[model samples]
Target: MSGLAASERSVRPSSGLSRFAAMFGKELLELVRSLKLIWVPIVFIALGIMQPVTSYYMPVILEKAGNLPDGSVIEIPLPTGAQVMAETLAQFGSLGALVIVLVFMGTVSSERNSGAVSMILVKPVSPASYLVSKWGAMLLLSSLSLLAGYGAAWYYTGFLIEAVAFKAVLSSFLLYELWLLVLLTLTLLLSTALRSAAGAAFAALGAGAVLSLLSNLFPKYAGWLPGALPGFARQAVMGSLEWSSRFGACLVATVMLLAALVLLANILLRRAAAID
Candidate 1:
């Protein structure tokens, strides 16, 4: 009888792993069949090309607009290559946030609404694995989107400018992408917690604004906010290797925020399972 119990226990783990793989594969196939795989990459690619293209010509456009009022000559400083790259990065990065929200809005929330979660759960999958697989999907897509955007920026910037260091450029671009992971994680938290997809998206956006407002309210603690992602990205692009206390603060906050998001998602998923 004891031997039989041990065999049964081992079988349970094997079954659980099988469920995990099934859940992961099903979600991946859904993404592909639904054209999510197509549009997400397309959106980021458009932004990537647009960013560098705009930056390359923006200075020219501004200069053509020429001097301003009071008969004072508007001295347009010649745009440096780094500054131009920064300008493109700024626009690309902002759009990256919106892309994350749109891409993830329906990641889990819609699954819940469409009764798809019920369908999957009936197949012996755990809610924890379900939630995790959704997060994994978001992270995977976001990473690819960032890479496409970075590749575009590199190509455009290289074509227009000389002496661009590949290492610095790639590092800066990657920092922007990592910060975006923070945003993706935040959205996952909201989507999991809220039953409504729209509600989840709005909540994530509102949370972003709140974090921004808090940065101003508690200036000293700004590094700890999600808003700090963009700032850190900027600093990283500029090659600030300084081991400032603020860097440590930003690192800690990013990790903590991600952890909180994961925990919240798991809790909500558990509640969801209990209801089922």
Candidate 2:
């Protein structure tokens, strides 16, 4: 009997993993059908290219404007490659984050409202599998989009501006990607917790804004928060960041918070399925 029980325990995890893969595949197919896989990366790449291009051409752009006097000289100092790359990430922090939130805002709630989740729950599928599948898909999408965008920005910055160290760019990318992950996870959590997709998006974005505001207003206190990630990313690019012990603490805290949110989302989704 002990041998049988042990065998059953081993089988359970394999089955669960299969279910998660199936669900993740379905989400990926849906993303493709919705053209999210195409347009999102395109948008990100556009935003990335815009940053370095605009930075490189600022003087020309200013001179082209009709308001400039004939003898006026625009001697604005050009930003370094690292600075340009940091500015590119700033684009992602604002508009790119919004795009991500809006795209996945309906990931779970829409299915719940449409009875799709009910259909799935009626089967033997685990709620944890369902939530994890959604999270995994979003993570893939976020990582791919950000990588494409940041790579483009890095290339442009090197070509137009000075060359930034690859190590610096990579470090900054990882840090900023963490910030994106937190925002994406927050949106997913909100989607499970709220019925309205718009409400979920608004709440997530609002929370992000509040975090950013607090971090900016009180850097000494809020430096350990996830909101300070962008600052850390910038510092990485500029090679000015001291590898503080708190940096690891903040990373761990952010990850723990994300895990808690995912767990809560799973529980809420299970309850929602029962109610339906």
lDDT string for model 1 (126-242, tens) is 778887777778777777877786677667767775335666677677666667776677788888777887777778877776775676477686756766655655555556646
Off by over 4 Å in 1: 1-15, 59-75
Q: Rate the local accuracy (lDDT) of all candidates.
A: 0.71, 0.89
- TM per candidate comes to 0.82, 0.93
* Residue 185 local lDDT, model 2: 89
Steric clash pairs (candidate 2)? none
> RMSD of each candidate?
4.8, 4.4
- Indicate the TM-score of model 1: 0.82
Per-residue lDDT over 79-157 for candidate 2, one digit per residue giving the tens place of the 0 to 100 score: 9898898899899999999999999999899998999999998877899888888888888888889999999999988
Report the C-alpha displacement of residue 196, candidate 1, in angstroms.
1.8
